[model samples]
Target: MPAAALKNKPLPTQSTAKRSVLFDSPYAPMAKHRLPAGRPREWYVTHNRRLKAMRLAIALLDSGVYLANQAHDETIRSTAEEIGVHPPSNTTCHMVRALMRYSR
Candidate 1:
């Protein structure tokens, strides 16, 4: 992908084809954090900070502050720790990788 290719694209909309593709593919897995059996019906809080952290990580990597393969895990771990969110482990990384592949 070229830098120019992404330069003028509008921000993605929720109903975009990419989202449809995600929902239709194997990348769309069940949520890991579901209410247990017999649990009261309650809304789970959205962790907006997690998305922020991911965006930050992506930005830093794009800016050449960190190599994609080198220090990526540690950077994610440290950033998550700073934000008090548990860092995703290898399993989560694998899922993310699959999702990225599907999106591309």
Candidate 2:
């Protein structure tokens, strides 16, 4: 357990170890949580839009588009298409740019 004794040992990683059987099973029961009730329809729509925008923003950052101005509506929409998501609307594109701007 001494530091010097452990220096030559490599850390365990996913590829080097066997995971639990539960995780490897195809029939394992997955947990699903339902959203809370009573919210307006528009609230749900906007919430999903926000989530999508956030995803697109992060994708743009990953692809080297850091500035809000650099991430135009067309760029955001194209990124969404590349990532297998539907093209974002103008409002969602604006939200994505806003998110990039404030994230700085």
Best by TM-score: 2
The clash count for each model shown is 0, 0
Q: How many Å off is the CA of 81 in candidate 2?
A: 0.6
Worst 10 residues of 1 by lDDT: 18-27
lDDT of 1 by residue, 1-53 (tens): 98886765343233212111111111222245644455434322224333444
Cα lDDT of model 2 by residue, 1-104, tens digit: 78876654343222211211111112222254675789998988998899889888877787678899887766776667555577889999999999999998
Q: Score each candidate by Cα lDDT.
A: 0.40, 0.69
| Runs off by more than 4 Å, candidate 2 | 1-33
Measured with C-alpha atoms, the lDDT of residue 10 in candidate 2 is: 42
Candidate 2 lDDT (Cα, 0 to 1)? 0.69
